[model samples]
Target: MKKTVVVGMSGGVDSAVAAATLVEQGYHVQGVTLQTWEPEDNATTSKKWQERGCCKIGLARFVAQRLSIPHQVLDIRERFRSAVVEDFIGGYSAGLTPNPCVRCNERVKFGCLMEAARDLGADYVATGHYARLLSGGTRGPHLHKGGDPRKDQSYFLYRLSRAWLPRILFPVGGLRKEDVWPKAEAIGLPADEVKESQEICFVTKG
Candidate 1:
């Protein structure tokens, strides 16, 4: 049977291309987006919503349809609040600058999401992160910098559990960020028109 992979699509060019690349490689790809934040007030106005990464569920669905894959949005707001939100707030309270992306990857993306993928009988969970997973090295598994140094995301993913490395995939990790949009467009995924996700998905700009 062909392996099944659940890809975390943020509706950005990288993730759009990641899903398409996996489909081309013969894996049964499923797309999932996490609804991690909800604005408490006017902070979540339409303009601000468009700026958050995880709020692009519409575009993610568009990419899934283009790839002919099933897509779903997982409401992980409560968990994200305790796992990442509180942690981020705590860090600031302690006068420390924390990397919430790293924490989210370790606790949410690869943590909660991987568990969900397993529940769906998927063999792996994939994302658009620009980092590569290498196996059978001198050690059991290693996460390496992506091929494109300018866009490598290894630093943000350094906190991922070593045990989960075997079941994780980053299809676009080998490509330059510059090439991701064109590839998404080539695959007819509409997310090529979506802006790149560069901000913290949960933080609202004041």
Candidate 2:
């Protein structure tokens, strides 16, 4: 059987191309979006939400629908807050520093989303994350850069394990952004050509 891949599509061009590349590679692909953190009255976060590209579910769902793949929206609000969110605030509160998205990638995205994909019959979970998984003959798993350094996401994924490395796929890892879009367009990939999202979703709530 062709391996089944569950792709975490965040409604962005990068992820849109990722899914298409996987399908082109003959893997049975499924798409998913995570609904993390609802917008509370936290003005600070809300302001940031209004800023730039944040993870947006509507955008993600739209892309999934366009791709003609089954899309599931999983609520990981509590998990994000505890694992990625609180740790973010806690880091600043303690006068130390933290990387929330990295936390999300490790604790929630790879951690929780992987299990969700398994429940959906996926043998492998994929993301549009621009990090490549490298397994040398003897070296443990390492994340390498995407062809597009501007979009490279390996820094946030350094914590992913050697165990999980083999099960993860990065369709956009080898391709540059310029290459991704033209191909996606040729394949009739569905996703906004121009998206305004750049912040985490929950930060936008009222």
Which ranges in model 2 have alpha carbons more than 4 Å from their true place?
Answer: 39-54, 187-193, 196-206
Residue 146 Cα positional deviation in candidate 2, in Å, after optimal superposition:
1.5
Report the Cα lDDT for residue 42, model 1.
50
Best-performing candidate as measured by lDDT? 1
The lDDT, on a scale of 0 to 1, for candidate 2 is: 0.72
lDDT (C-alpha) at residue 162 in model 1: 85
lDDT of 2 by residue, 23-53 (tens): 8789888988776755323445324324233
On TM-score, the leading prediction is: 1
Angstrom error at residue 23, model 2: 1.4
Poorest 10 consecutive residues of model 2 by lDDT? 45-54
**Per-residue lDDT of candidate 1, residues 1-206 (tens digit):** 99999999876778888999999999999999887876323543334425565646666776898899999988888988899989999998999998888898888877866877988999999999999987867667789999999999999999888888888999999988778878877877544246666777777689
List where candidate 1 sits over 4 angstroms from the true fold. 39-49, 190-192
lDDT scores of the candidates, listed in order: 0.82, 0.72
Model 1 alpha-carbon miss at residue 199, Å: 2.5
RMSD of 2: 4.8
